[model samples]
Target: MPLRPSRDVFITCAVTGAGDTTSRSDKVPVTPHEIADAAVEAARAGAAIAHIHVRDPKTGRPSRDLELYREVVEKIRASGVDVVLNLTAGAGGDLVLGSPEAPLPPDPAGTDMAGAGERLAHVAALLPEICTLDCGTMNFGEGDYVMTNTPAMLKAMAARIRELGVRPEIEIFDTGHLVLAKWLKDQGLIADPVMVQLCMGIPWGAPDDLGSLLAMTANLPDDWTFSAFSIGRNQLPYAGLALAAGGNIRVGLEDNIWLKKGVLASNGDLVERAVAIAEAMGSRVMTPGEVREKLKLERRW
Candidate 1:
C-alpha cells in the first residue's frame, strides 16, 4: 500500500499509565485529583481524547479501585472538559512467573489476574465513551512477566464493551495482535468504526523502526481508524510518522516522560508538542466532537 498521509488527525493523550514511573519522574500523576487535572490540562492543550489509569494515592502504584476511578471521572466531568474519556481496561491481566526453574507458582505480588467483568469494573460503572482492549497476550518486558489476555477473556470483554455502547481502542502491540483484532471483528464482537492503537517500541513487542511501523499500517483494514505511538525518544517523532501513515497521533506522560534531554514533561506538554507537529505537517488537530463523530462514539455523560 502507498503512503497516504492523514489530513484530519485526532490526538489521544495517555495521561498516566500503570507503570512504575512515578519514582522516576515527579510529573506522573498519582492522586485522582492529579490525574483528572492532567486530563483537563491535556484537553486544553488540544488533545481530542484522554486515556486514563488510576494509581494508589499513597503508594503511587497502579490500582483498580472503583472509587478512585469514580473520583477521577467525576472530577473531569465536573471540570467541564470536553475531551473524550478513554478509560483503560488493560490492568487486570498482568502475570509474573515465579522463576525459570519454578514457573508453576506465579508471583502473587507482581501478578494481577481477573475475569473480564472484574477487569472492566470501572468501565461498567462509569461508562466512559471509549476503553482499551488488548487483543492478544505477549511478553510485556524483560522478565517472567507476560501481558495475558486470552481469546476467551477478550471475547467476553469485547462483547460487554459492545453492550455498553463504548468503542474499543484495540491495543495492537505486535502484528499478530492485529490478526486477532480482525478475528474479533469476524466474530461480530467488535462493531463498525473500529478504533485501534498501534502501540510500538515496547520491549518484547514490535520494534519502533520505520519498517516495522510501515508493515503494521500496511496490514490494517482501510476502513479501520488507527493511531500509532512509540515510547521514549521516538514518542514525539512518531507524531510525524503516524500522520504520514494515514493514522492519528497518541502522546503523553504514559508513553514518555521527557520533553527534552533533561526535561520532564507533563501530559499537557506532550500534547502541545503533538499539536505543533501535526500542524507543522499541514494536518488539522481534531477536537473531541470531531473524534466522536469519526469513531461513532456513544458518550455516556
Candidate 2:
C-alpha cells in the first residue's frame, strides 16, 4: 500500500514578498501594523509559517530599512500569534541590467547590490528561525535583467548565516540553481538536510509543468527536504504536487493575489485554501508547535 502523511503537514503563508507588486493590488500590507496583522490572520487560517518581506510604507516599495524590519518582527512576536518567522535576505539584490548599447554601467534605477553581511543585517538581529537564500541568478520574467547570486557571494552569505545559527531555505528557480545549492552543501557552507524551495513558472525561468517540476525534484539528494510552488493560478495545484513528492506547501498573497479568477484574496484566504487542499489529501494541517518540532525550529522570542 502507498504511504500517506499520517501527521499534519505544515503550511507557510508568504505574507508579503519583496516584489514591487503593491501597485497591482491594494491588499498587500505596507506598514508594520498591517504586515503583522496579515501574518496573524494567516496563522489563524492554518499557516504554521509566515514568510515576510517588509516595504517602505510611504512608497510601497521594497526596503532594507532594518528599523522597518525590526518593527515588523517585534510586532509579530508580541502579537501572540503563534507562527514560524521566515525573513527574506533577498531585499537588496534587485539587479536591473543596463542597455546593451552601454553595458559597462548598470542602469542607475536597476542595480542595487549590497555586501552579504549588509544584505543579512536584518536577519542577524531579528534572528528568525528561517531565512531565504536565493540559490542562483536567473532571468526573472521577460525583464531585461537577471537575478544574480554568484557562487562566491552565496558562499560568503551562507557562511554568515551559519554563523548566526539561522537556517537558510534555498530558493531554487531552476534546475541549475539546485546544483549550486548542493555544491554549497558539499562545501560545508550550508548545513545538512538543506531545505529547498522549487519556484516555477515565472516567465524566463523554469516553467510550471510536470516534467520541469519532476526534473528539479529528482535533482535533490535523498537527505534534502524540498518544496515546490507555481505562481498565480498554479499555486494550489503545486501544493498538491509538493505533498505527493513528500514536500511541504507555501501560499499567500506574495505569489498569488486572487482566490479565484476575479476575486481578491487576503492572506488568510490563501492559507485556508491550502489547508483545505492538504486536508482533502488526508494530510493534517500542522500548527505552529507541530512545525517547530518538524523543522527543529526555535520560536521567535
Candidate 3:
C-alpha cells in the first residue's frame, strides 16, 4: 500500500506511563494531582487525548490503586479541560521470573500479575472514552520481565470495556500482535472501527525501522483507524511519519523524556512539539471534539 498523507490528525499524549522513570527525571508526574495537572497542560497545549497511568505517590513506582486513578480522573474532569481520556488497561500484566536456574517462582518485587477483572477495575469505575487492550504478550525489556496478556484475558477485558461503552485502543507491538487484534475483531469481541496503536522500538518488540512500520501498516484492515509511535528520539520523527501514513500520532513523557537532547520534557512540551511537526507537514491538529466525532467515542461521564 502507498503512504497516504492525512490532512487532519489527532494527537494522544501518554501523560505518565507505568514505567520507573520518576528518578531519571523529576518531570515524570507521580502523584495523582501532578498527573492530572500534566494531562490538563497537554490538553491546553493541543492534545486531543490524554492517555493516563497513575503511580505510587511515595515511591514513584507504577501503581494499580483504584483510588489514585479516581483522584486523577476527578481532577482532570474538574479542571474544565476538554481532553478525551484514554486510561491504561495494560498494567497488572508484568511478570518477572526468577533466575534461569530457579524460574519456577516469580520475583515478587518485579511481578505484578492480576486477573482481567482486577486490571479493569479502574476502567470500569471511571469509564474513560478509551482504554488500551494490549493485543499480545511479549518480553517487555532487558530483565526476565514478560508483559503477559493471554487470549482469554484480552477477550474478557474487551467485552468489559464494550459493556462500559468505552473504546479499546488495540495496542500492537509487532506484526503478530496486529494479526491477533484482527482476529479479535473478527471474532466480534472488539467493537467496529477498531482503533489501534502501533507501538514501535520497545526493546525486543518491533524495531523502529521504515520497513517494519510499513509492513505493520500494510497488514492493518483498511477500515481501521490507527495511530503509530516510537520511543525516545524517534518519537518526533514518527509523528510526521504516522501522519504521512494516514494515521494519528502519540507523544508524551511516557514514550520519550527529551524534548531535545539534554532537555527533559513534560507532557505539554511533547504535545506542543508533536503539534508543530504535524502542522508543519500540512496536517491540521484535531481538537478533542473532532477526535471524538472521528472515533465515534462515547464519553460516559
The residue-by-residue lDDT of candidate 2 on 64-163, one tens digit each, is: 8999989988998998879889898886677787767766577767677898999999999889999999988887756567688899889999999989
Each candidate: how many clashes? Answer: 0, 0, 0
List pairs with backbone clashes in candidate 2.
none
Model 2 reaches what TM-score against the true structure? 0.95
The superposed Cα distance between candidate 3 and the true structure at residue 32, in angstroms, equals 0.3
**Candidate lDDT values, in order:** 0.94, 0.84, 0.91
List the lowest-lDDT window of 10 residues for candidate 2: 1-10
lDDT of 3 at 220: 85
Cα lDDT of model 1 by residue, 1-301, tens digit: 6778999999999999998889999999999999999999999999999999999999999999999999999999999879899999999999999989999789998899999999989999999999999999999777899999999999999999999888999999999999999999999999999999999999989999999999998899889999999999999999999999999999998999999999999999999999999999999999999999989987777
Give me the runs in candidate 2 sitting further than 4 Å from their true place. 1-7
Q: Give one digit per residue, the lDDT tens place, for model 3 in 164-241.
A: 889999999988898889888888889887899999999889998988999899898889999999998999999988
Least accurate stretch of 10 residues (summed lDDT) in model 3? 292-301
Q: What value does the lDDT take at residue 74 in candidate 1?
A: 96
- Candidate 3: misplaced stretches above 4 Å? none
**Models ranked on TM-score:** 1, 3, 2
